[model samples]
Target: MPSSAGPSIDTITEGGRVTQVGEGQEAEESVPPVMTFGAPTAGEILAERYELVEHINNDSAGRLVWRGVDVVLRRPVAVVLRYPGGDSATEMLQAAVAASRVIHPNLVGVYDAIDEAERAYVVREWVDGQSLREMVADGPLDPGRATAIGNAAASALAAVHATGMVHGNMHPGTVMISQEGRVVLADARTDGADSRENDVRAVGGILYFALTGHWPHAEAPLRGATAGHGRAAIPDGVRDASGAIAAPRQVRAGVPAYLDDLTMDLLDAGIAPPPSDVLAAELGRLDIPIEEEPYPEPAGPLRFAAETGDEPSPLASVGGRKVAIGIAGLLAVALVGLLIGISALGGDDDPLQTEPVARPSSSAPASGAAPAAATRKLSVSDVRIIDPDSKLRDELGGAERVTDGDQDKGWDTDTYTQPNFGNRKSGMGVWIDLGEEHTVKSVQVSLSATGASAQLFAGKTDPPSTSAGDKLLFTSYRTNPVGQPFEEHDGTTMTFNGFDADAKYRFLLFWLTALPSNDRGYQVGVLEITVQGS
Candidate 1:
């Protein structure tokens, strides 16, 4: 039988006995050696520079984390190693390189990424404290403390997004709190799989986990999750029948209202996630600043001798003068009051002369005389995704297609189980920026199928969500149905007329309510959009 040893070490079997082989030792046993795999041990130097000191833990991505030392630089470092290197090292190397480019106080520093044929590893800053995961494991964190950690993470993400990169993997496990109370985000896995919006949501998730001790993104693969496998096991977010996850406050007590709102907004898939920089600024404002304790007040009053003076002592002279002036001021005020009373009595006999009140000037037109402003063609740019159904379709359509005068190609929605987006959402629509606010008279749409219902919404700002059309632009529902359905052969030409012509409008939404097809998975295609305004 052959003795088993780690991949980093060599071993030999000597006649039914297993013996470990040291460096520069020839195999005395005639038996062949068996190969086994394990992590690098102490005194093992990787790439002839990093010496493994001790096993810290395992990362969520099935990587072993070790506390190591850079032999050349003589500095402490944390090394994350993955086995069977070569192809497996691709993502690890890519993540390391991307993270290394961003230098931020809230981001963990990356030193090197190396592959040694048998294994691949990333060397980074060694944080000598617990992960957010470890802290929350004991119990929930204080709301103020959680907010600070969130602010740091968001600020770090803003830096990452500024470079047009996304930190695809953001969980409590990745958030490190050093012994010095420094918050840093580690391990940015940019697989091009998750978008920048996911990064923002992850910050909210972190706060939720810190407060409620529950992971809102339940499917997240966390470190110490499985026994002797990955990292810690993160608890899943609680969801109701509609699949809507409850807010952090609903899950746990002591969560502040402001924090609850912020967390909920980030987690809301319906609304567009606020930009990273904007979110960072908001979090910054909410972060409670550390206050120093105030100095204790003196117990006794000062006892200072008055200076000998040809001129009186400054303090005594000033105090005496102030008292005399105060008495004189009171007498003068009484005399003035008597004179004012006498004048008012005399004015009562004659008509009191008064200045007229002035009215402020106004720029708005008088009632019922508002002119119908001249209209011009508006460009349809700044198209954005507003999928109410939460369908993850990146290639829905562009705003250019609707105004490009191309009947051949236009934007369409993904196939849905039901006609109305499976009742998961109120509706879906494409937003058209009119460049500036206008008096939108009407909008006409050409659809591929008949009887497709839609609405025209005009607003100043982009609609927060698909179902949120009612919240902005107009107080009531904006879903004004198009004209009667036409035959399939002729296609449908529906016009949305009679908009609030006096009301200012900038962003117009053509929201679809019902699909025309009776198929199992149905979708609607808008070929062209004609805007008539004045």
Candidate 2:
């Protein structure tokens, strides 16, 4: 049987079984081996579907990790195998089932969990990337990259937490950054000991490790770091004499103050961390544009008003002296009011001086000048999915839902092998047509995930509702873009507010240049399309 060194073992029992027992360690009782036969050979198919190709390594809990392929789907997968499955592998299978229910772009997709009585296995999405631990093996990551990674991890946790489940396993090893720059979280554990709060705090640990290349010892024990182990793969955080881990800014130069504050607050036991979704939003706001600016403009410290249900006044903490000064200023204005009152008594005699007031004109405005119109939501008369590349046109079915005003349900692209549709096509889009030409003030597109590259376009003519027409429309829109393209937008909601308000537009194309990475592959959901104009 092939065996590899697992996460550092605390004690080897009489039967040579590794048992980890202590605070923060998952409780597992040592049991006799179930498999008396030889280990699985390369290319051996499990469940007659998954064929193991290569062995990756043994995980911290001594489970076998292998690179495999799903024969039916012809897609790569990761297979985890454990011996004596029935009772011992319950937690692993349960976690896999729970994680499979919550799908997010930043989470590893759980495909199948099976127990064959003698052994158990789980098949999941195979990520062609290195773990955060490997990425920072040489040194720390830059602030922008670190922030982006943190935002992705937090976003994934928010999705998991939304389903009322906890990602018990969170650390550097589980945070995978793909070659395509997609950050995803993997390897969830279902131990009853972990909490959602811990999961939220783990994001801080991720940021600290990315920024400083050191894991905070005060945090939950890392996967491989066990008691009595000579040393862990990642180094412990630098601590002061008071035994407190140093903040990222203290450990490294060039760390932003706001980021430093956020990281420390999450790690601080005294300060409660915000909910996962709120934390994700804050991080997304701070994740500066890599091409535009190296550092984001100073965003003040995060205030968790949402969690506390307290909307503090902007001037709640005004000093007494400042308040007194404001009162004096008001009193001075009151005295001036008194003088005005006295002047009003002699108004007829003094012929009170006043500026002329402009009155409304009953006649029409001058020629060629139009009155400014108030913006209102424009009704979309027709909408359709425009996919020129695929002959099947299978992804075009749910186009109407995008303009249905229901964000929960909408149209989505079929999962592609790559972010750019695997080079199969240039792009895909949703073609929207207003009943007639109207001034387009703004177009807001709500997407299901972030990191998609898209652009909005307006054209005079509407093409045929066929694949051939789609090709022509796509070519025209690509050549003539209406507003600025959102390249790798950090948020799911994108507002193209640069439309020419004076220009009349009847046909508009919401084109997606690139799709965000989902657990299955590259895909995106257009939740809703809202157009506001006169």
- C-alpha displacement of 292 in model 2, angstroms? 4.0
Kindly list the per-residue Cα lDDT of model 1 for residues 457-534, writing each as its tens digit: 655555454435334533432543322222222235444444443466667677777776656576778877756453
- Weakest ten-residue segment in model 1 by summed lDDT: 339-348
Misplaced by over 4 Å in model 2 are: 1-34, 218-220, 223-231, 304-534
What are the lDDT figures for the candidates, one per model? Answer: 0.51, 0.61
Model 2, span 1-534: residue lDDT tens: 111111111111213332211112221235222344557779999988999987654443545656789999999866767776777666555555555556577765556778876887766666565667667876999899999999888887777677776665566755667667877665444333456767777888889889999887433333334442211446888887856677777788988765776676566543345567767866786777666777853423352111122232222222110111000000000001100000000000110101110111111235796544534467889999999888888888999999887879999888899999888988889999989998765677879988899988887767897888888888776766764677887767665644553468888999898999978999999998877665
Candidate 1 Cα outliers beyond 4 Å, as residue runs: 1-41, 57-64, 82-91, 219-232, 236-243, 251-254, 290-435, 438-534
Model 1 whole-model lDDT (C-alpha atoms): 0.51
Rate residue 191 of model 1 by lDDT: 37
TM-score of 1: 0.47
Query: In lDDT terms, which candidate is top?
Result: 2
Cα deviation of 35, candidate 2, in Å: 3.3
